[model samples]
Target: MRAGPLCLLLAVMSMATGAHAEESSPLSLSAGPQIIDLQQRLKESEHQRDELSKQLQNADADRESAQLSRLRQENQRLKLQLKEAQATAPQRLLTDQQQWFVTGGGVAMVALLCGIFASGWRRQRRQWLN
Candidate 1:
């Protein structure tokens, strides 16, 4: 019975040692076109990235041009509206805005002249004119 158990233990230890050796071994390299294939994949990825970058740049340029054109159109539309408003507004509005200060000055001068005339008449009455 002891011999049988010892033999079983030896077999188990041998299997464990073999498993550890396999775990520590390095993987063997392929000698075919694997390296060339990897390089081709890398180049393809680079080319794809370059193409995508160019496409993005083109999209951005198109977007910018569209924005510029839209702004220019809006500016033209606003100018048209301004011209139409000028044509439709009361013509007197411009005259009034431009000459309000002159109108106010004329009224002030008339009021001053009236006050002077009234005061002169009152003073002459007090002086007893023959």
Candidate 2:
């Protein structure tokens, strides 16, 4: 009884495999032209992609070069301005406002010192009974 079922299973498996093989052979015969066409399309698309990438790189390089030239010009102009500034006469160390502020501070310090010194106890002022 076991052998009978085993034989039936084997027979069904063989028929299924044979049917799959027959179907795949016809498909493979017709797929030759389709595969070649797909490969050619892939190559064309790859070529287009390469060209587009090169164009993008060239555009970037052009923009970068233009910016570099502008920066160089600006640097040169700034250098000239710096040289002109350095060639001019030396300026005073302090501006008018700063000088005035320093003078005021000195006067305040002198006033404070004088006040402390003048307020010292004198002989007459030391007599608390007077």
* Model 1 bad stretches (over 4 Å): 1-39, 92-100, 122-130
**lDDT tens digits, residue span 23-85, model 2:** 887556778899999999999999999999999999999999999999999999999999999
Query: Which candidate number would show the highest lDDT if scored against the true structure?
Result: 2
RMSD of each: 11.2, 5.7
TM for every model, in the order presented, reads 0.50, 0.58
Error at 13, model 2, angstroms: 12
Task: State residue 34's C-alpha deviation in candidate 1, in Å.
Answer: 7.5
lDDT string, candidate 1, 37-96, tens digits: 999999999999999999999999999999999999999999999999999986774466
lDDT of each: 0.90, 0.92
Q: Give the TM-score of candidate 2.
A: 0.58
Total colliding residue pairs, candidate 2: 0
Native RMSD of candidate 1 (Å)? 11.2
**Number of backbone collisions per candidate:** 0, 0
Give the per-residue Cα lDDT of candidate 2 at 13.
100
